[model samples]
Target: MTLLQSLIECLGPSNVLTDADAQPYLTDWRRYSTGCAVAVVRPASTDEVAAVVKLCAKYRAPIVPQGGNTGQVAGATPDRSGTAVVVNMQRMNRIRDIDVDNETMTVEAGCILAAVQQAAREAGKLFPLSLGAEGSCFIGGNLATNAGGTQVLRYGNARELALGLEVVTPQGEVWHGLRGLRKDNTGYDLRDLFIGSEGTLGIITAATLKLFPLPQTQHTAFIALPDFESATLVLNRVKKAFGAALTGFEVMSEQCLSLVVKTFPEQRMPINCQRPAPEWFALLELSDSEGGEHRRDGFELVLSDAMEASEIIDAAVAASESQGAAFWHLRESITLALAAEGKCIKHDISLPTSRLADFVRDVDAMLLARYTGLRMMVFGHLGDGNLHYNMLAPATLSKARFEQLEAQAQALVHDQVVARGGSISAEQGIGQRRVEDLRRYKDPVELALMVRIKQALDPLGIMNPGKLLA
Candidate 1:
């Protein structure tokens, strides 16, 4: 039998998609990276994945491991060469086990993030790694990307949440390391090796994720800070006052909020009216694992203190569940509104919390001087020091002309990020989108070591080729 025939026989024809049926897996969500693949194979279990990988190794065919395909960096999409077989792991969706005593859950790679969250909730737990794409993004993809969402401030990123991982090696060998131990001082951490490797090292088939007690009184509030600088001060004040209860702290500039109001009329401003809209807004949420109404009172007191200190000009507290959802809707709509605007140059960078305000101001100053009629939108997880700095072309500039400035804009912002001791790709891994940029900014020695590790793990260079290491 041919290579495709073997895959069909192993996985059954219903699971192995080809030609017209595989178009959805060929393109990325951003529609930025388009590629061709011989077939899109859906393996129902870890053994099947191993078999598929072994067959691809025999044929010398490359394998692009994909989950949900919701990654912004096009890490899951195939290349245009059509020499690759896309391995879709969604069919393996299953909660293998939930160790309530250990506070951990063993979940298959294909499980949706939102579904995992729901399962944990039903079991009286909270899987805190949350993002707007949680509904469709899979657990394996989250682990592959080491995704950081709203709760990174208190809990941590996807990397920290995972206690153990079961990966299928690039050589088609299964390495079962799913031990939910809190401390194992054993040799090198092989789990870390694959967590953020972007499938270049191995395919993560399952993971034992860490879970936390569900917050009893989760409170969300929207406050308009006085200026850009006030955001950091507000974050500091909340951290000092609320301590561990402070789960999230997000900041958004006036332009970012205005875009949402303009695009979606239903998402009117959350806070009551003032003389003029505050220059910036900060969204805060407090949560406690222990059940109590005092947690709610504490959050209210913090807002009062912030207002008294002149840090906030206006504020709105979510008194009910629907109100909290409405507040978050405004924050989530910013990205969708940006997409609606037009093509934009997006930079995800991290900096010291103290320097975030200045970075934004200085970057804007320099960008405005160089690129006339350029619009900027600033927002992101203020607590974690990551910013989604986006630049849009003014109407006078043509799309083709604006496209040419993408590289220059990336360099301009990244230069500032590095100077401030920050990272270019904060939460998002350096997939196809930032591979060249990673080369431009990453330390040579550090990158060389990573290359050595990749070579050691995938000697054939068939695992997700032409990604990460350049």
Candidate 2:
């Protein structure tokens, strides 16, 4: 049998998927790039992965590395060629080690992010990298994208949480660097090279991740803000008051909140009393080593001071864990709620914290002028200046026309982002979807350097082609 056939048969029928069997896995999570692959391979161990890669390399077959396939930017899907072999890492899920004493956990690439968080919690530690996709996204994908979530204000992104990595290079050689050391000061930080490369440089087989002490108490509150400017003011106030204890500060528009309530009736808003939906809302959370009583008092005092300063319109604090979770649930469900709407244009862009309010105003104004009656849903980790500025078509526009204008809409949005000295693609890496547009924002020198690195690592251009640098 041929190498590809041999690979499919050796990996077991269950682990190896192809044709109709691989249909679901071949497509992008957002259903944007519906590509076909020769096969989707799921290896349960590092050795098996190395063997598969070696076979693919011998056959000169391109590979698309996928984990959880939960990415929004079509990063994990294969192209339409139907010649690429997709390496799906979900079967490799395993938490190898949890060194509480060292404050680190070594886990396989395929492990779901939520599972890792639960493992840390069970060890009486905290794994703070969080997002709505935590339940379905894999740690490998998070590392590949350098994902930043709500708690980035406190802990940092996946790149910061990563201590070491075990990667399978394009040549099918396994580079094992899963050391739990905090400060190695090695010659070169090679692990970082692959972290945000979106599986172009290599396939991340596993990683040694940093953990933190679990917060003994957490206080969550939902507050109404006059606008994005006031949301920024509230964030600054809470940061000054609580410092590192201020764990999460998210902002949402009244339109976004209203959609969530209307779309998902099971979920309830967190306000103690209802008022005309304010222009904007903020989800503020605080975590401390102190007990619940101290956390409650601290959060309440901060809100009172902010209210006195007129930074907030009104607020409601969570009285119990369930209540706190409910507040977070509303924040986390924002994307899903918005997805229920018809055709949408999504932009995960970032600007300086100081420029965010102005940037939003200008972008919103520009888009409204170009696309009349467009419904805007702007919300995200306001603390870190990353907003999921998405626009939905008015009920009048047909889905076909809405999709056809996506390219033009993206160009407009990206132009504004570049003019503001902001990133066109923030948390989400430049997968195939944004590869061409990347040139508009990326410096030519930097792009050339990236190309050189790709040449050096995957000289044959066989490792996850048509992604990131393209």
Candidate 3:
């Protein structure tokens, strides 16, 4: 029988989608990349997944392992060959175990991120890997990308949060390495290899994730700042004041929040307009084990001192949990708002915290000087030095006309990033979107080692071909 027929047999006919059924799985989340597949198969268990992989290996058909279909970089989308089999893990959604005493939870690859967070909450613990697509993104996808979200400053990325992983190799063998121990210096860390491999190396079937005690009290604040320098000052001050209690420190350009308020009329800005509108804003959170008025008083006191020091232009502290959510809602709405406006040139970049201020000022001037009608929308986890620096075309330009400028603009931004000891792709892994950029900027020696590792792990290269490595 053919590969399609074999896949259908392994995972019933209903799970083996084709034609229109397979269309949804072919396109990337941003609709930028679309490819055809022989069949899209949903496997319910690790054994079933291994069976599918073995069948594909026997057929020599390319395999693209997908999770949630919510990736921004087309990493999960199949290519246009129409000969690849898309093995989706949505059906393997299960919470295998929750070790509350050890503060770790074992969950299947297909568990939705938000569902995992809620599960931890029910267990009176916190799984702090949060992002804009948490509602739809899967745990496996997060691991593949080594996703960095708001709480990354405190808890760390998906890689650090994960203690163990169950992966099916490109050769169809299952490596069950789910050790929940905090310290394991056994040998070559296969878990770290697969965590950010973007599914090019193997299929991650499940993981044991780190968890933390739920804070007794959490406070959120929105501060309007005069400029990027002042924002950095406020960041340093808060870092000194709160230390580990500071859960997150996010920064947004004035244009970013204004776009959110304009696009989503229902959502209100947290800051009052008694002071002149500021150029930048910082949204920070403090999580404390100790509750009561003292925690909040300390938070307010820091902001008051910052305002007095001119580090802050104005401040709005959340009075309740709902208000805190609302404050974050504004921050989260940025990408959606940009999507609504038009095509955007995006750069997920990170720099030394010290260099961020000068980098932004210099790059902003350079881009505006070169391009007449480019609008900037910058924001991100300032605490971690990752910024989503994006640009929109003038209203006069059509989609095609605007997209033509993407390559040149991206090169300009990335060149500056590399010059100042920064990364072109920070939290978001270099999927199909930034493959060429990775090739262009990555050090020759480091790139060679990566290629050798890819060859060593995947000899056939039938796994997620044309991603990460050329």
Q: TM-scores of all models? A: 0.97, 0.97, 0.99
In model 1, the clashing pairs are none
- Over 1-470, each residue of candidate 1 has an lDDT whose tens digit, in order, gives 88899999999999888889999998987788899997999998999999999999999899999999988788988889888999999998999999888999999999999999999999998889998788999999999988998889999889999999999998899999999998998999999889989999989999999989987777899998888898898899889998988999999988898999999987888876566767799898988777767877877888798889998888888888799888888888888898899877888888989898899889999999999877888889999998999877776667678767877888989998999999998887887999988898899999999999989999998899877885
Give the winner by lDDT. 3
Error of 3 at 428 (Å): 1.1
Tens digits of per-residue lDDT, candidate 3, 1-470, equal: 88888888788899999999999999998899999999999999999989988888888888899998887788888889898899999999999999999999999999999999999999999999999999999999999999999998899989999999999998889999898988888789889999999999999999999999998999999999999999899989999998999999999998999999999999888876555678899999999988798979999999999999999988999999999999999999999999999878999999988999999999999999999888899999999999998998787777777777888899999999999999998888887899999999999999999999999988888889878885
List per-prediction Cα lDDT, in the order shown: 0.89, 0.89, 0.92
Ranking of candidates on lDDT, top first: 3, 1, 2
Q: What is the lDDT of residue 290 in candidate 3?
A: 82
Q: Model 2, which residues run further than 4 Å from truth?
A: 272-275
Global local distance difference test of model 2: 0.89
Please, what are the lDDT tens digits per residue for candidate 2 over residues 1-470? Answer: 67667786669878888778888898787788888887899999988888888888888888899999989889998888888899999888999999999999999999999999999999999999999999999999999999999999898889999999999999889999999988899688998999999999999999999999998888889998877898889898889888999989999988888889899999887774456668889998998887748668877998999888888889999888899999888888888887777677899998888999998888788888888888889899988889999988876777778777777888888888888889987799899989898876799999999999999999888888888877
